[model samples]
Target: MNLNKAWGILKENGFKETTKRNQILEIFEGDERYLTARDILDVMQKDYPSMSYDTVYRNLATFVSLDILEATELSGEKHFRMHCESDHHHHHFICMDCGKIKEIPLCPMDLLGAALPAYEIDNHKFEIYGKCPECK
Candidate 1:
């Protein structure tokens, strides 16, 4: 019936060619930022008359499940952005003004001296935030 899976993917940009999915992808492409659910729905409404909040949430959930999107919290709200990973250990520098991600090839742990005593360190996250070159 060409209902949900109507769009044929042209490449490996973590998106199918469907109208709705493509629209969502275009939003991310236009601005690589951490988008909240409302942000996505607001942008999609301009192009899709029948699009709903639930639909947007569902699609976002799918993307997160597939690891194509990363959901994180900022201030007190949750946002989503494209997921990029390398085969090695590294970090990212995010532009606070514009959510552009830049890879940092160094690990902070390497410069440290063990786990600061017995603190039960399970995992850690590292990200630097500032304006990007374009934004600057």
Candidate 2:
């Protein structure tokens, strides 16, 4: 995504666009993979040498909060990916070795919700992990 699209997304969420935010978004612009804070920092620090760890973390939290990004905790570390909501809700099968993502056709919670009507469901996150074709 270009700077304009990034700005547009931020504006749609009522967030003011900034250099740092754009730089952060650029890291995932054309990539469809999970990235850790350190992974992002390594790429960002090349241009933004003064960027701090806290700044990357804060921006990540903001992106996740704004629904522009999704975070999944894997192996005790949080990994982030761009979020694009489709008409039908689904989950993902994430390749642990390559960070490749494959969309799951159905959500398990839908069936669970039907089975447990009394439970009030607020949110859900699902990710399956394994090796990708190339990795295998």
The residue ranges of model 1 lying beyond 4 angstroms of the native Cα positions read 1-18, 110-122
Any idea what lDDT model 1 has?
0.72
Q: Report the lDDT of model 2 for residue 86.
A: 67
lDDT of 1 by residue, 1-136 (tens): 0112213223344554567877776676556678899999998888887789998898888777766667776668778876654657777887888777788999888776585877676777887889999999
Task: Please name the candidate that would achieve the greatest lDDT relative to the true structure.
Answer: 2
Candidate models: Cα lDDT each: 0.72, 0.82
**Overall local distance difference test of candidate 2:** 0.82
- Residue-wise C-alpha lDDT for candidate 2, range 1-136, written one tens digit per residue: 3446556777998887778888788777767889999998998899989889998999899888866788889899999988855657888888988897888989888678578678887887887889888888
User: Against the true structure, what is each candidate's TM-score?
Assistant: 0.68, 0.87
User: Among these predicted structures, which one has the highest TM-score?
Assistant: 2
Q: Candidate 2: where is the Cα deviation over 4 Å? A: 1-5
Cα lDDT for residue 63, candidate 2? 83
